[model samples]
Target: MSLIYVLDILGTFAFAISGALVASDKKFDLFGVLIIAFVTAVGGGMLRDVLINAHPINWIGDLNYLFVIFTAVVFTFLFKSKIAHLSKTMFLFDTVGISVFTLLGLEKGLSYDLHPIIALIMGMISAVFGGVLRDVLTNKIPLIFQKEIYASACLAGGITYLILNHFHIPENIIFIISASIIIIIRVIAVKFELELPKIKDDLFTKK
Candidate 1:
């Protein structure tokens, strides 16, 4: 498989695991866990496809995606204790997944001749929308809305990918560098508990 394809598969697997982990924490049944895994794995891609008119969607064209998600769910089921205890490890995997997926989304948008701004937005959505849905369904606040450096990291990476591609950098190197930037920023932000400023509830008055 191509490097891009490998990264895509890895990202899907990581996302599936994240979803399964959350579902397990909520005491969801096996079917519910699998549903969360499947949805988290492909939700963003499906949205991107719909918006871009990439009909039939990506998972439809590739059963391997489904296989990967199923495998992730199985792995999570068999090793819930070990995996559940590794919150930092899970975060690391999630960082990698979002970074890689963001680049993939940006590349797809560019390929479709979409504007760069739209491409960047799609990239952010591709990385975080699934997580948002996962959190909402699980009755937790979405990470992106919690002042953490979540979606912003994806946005930074997506924009960096576009800039590098604009300058004609080697595709593989560009992908690696852009993803690294994202992962680094996320790790640093999490490690230091860095958060973006939130709008204070009293900052605005009724007109």
Candidate 2:
């Protein structure tokens, strides 16, 4: 299989695991856990496809995606205690998922003849919207809306991909470098508690 396809599956798996863990923490039952896992694994890609008018969606046609998500849920259930004990387990899986999803979605948009800028937006959406949906469903704030460097990392990675592609970089190398940029940026941002500046305190005050 192609490296891109493998990365896509891996991202899906990671997202599914993360979702399952969150659902478990929320005391969701089996059905709720499965639903959350499914949404977290494919919600972003589905939104991206619909925005681009891609027919059939992705997981709808590809049973492999479903299989990967199912496997992830099972794995999460089997190792719930052990995985939960690791302080950075969710962070690690989430970082991997977003990094891979950003590049894959960006490349998909480019293949559809989208402008590079629009494709970068698509990349950001694909990387973060799944988590957005998950957080919304779980009654928590979405990370993208928070001050943390979430979608920005995806945008940075997408820009890196575009710049490398402009120079005719090898596809495999570009994928690795671009995804690594997203992962590294996310890691550094979280490690140092870096966040975007908040809105002015008086912006919403009475005139």
The parts of candidate 1 lying over 4 Å away from their true place are 201-207
Tens-place lDDT digits, model 1, residues 1-207: 297788788889889999998899899999999888988889898889999998778899899999999999999989888885877777777788899889888888888899999998888878888888888888888867987798778888888898999899989899999999999998898889899887666648575
The true-versus-predicted C-alpha distance at residue 120 of model 2, in Å, is 0.7
Question: What stretches of model 2 exceed 4 Å from their correct place?
Answer: 86-90, 201-207
Alpha-carbon lDDT of model 1: 0.87
Clashes of each: 0, 0
TM match of model 1 to true structure: 0.91
TM-score, structure 2 vs. true:
0.90
RMSD of 1: 2.6
Model 1 residue pairs with clashes: none
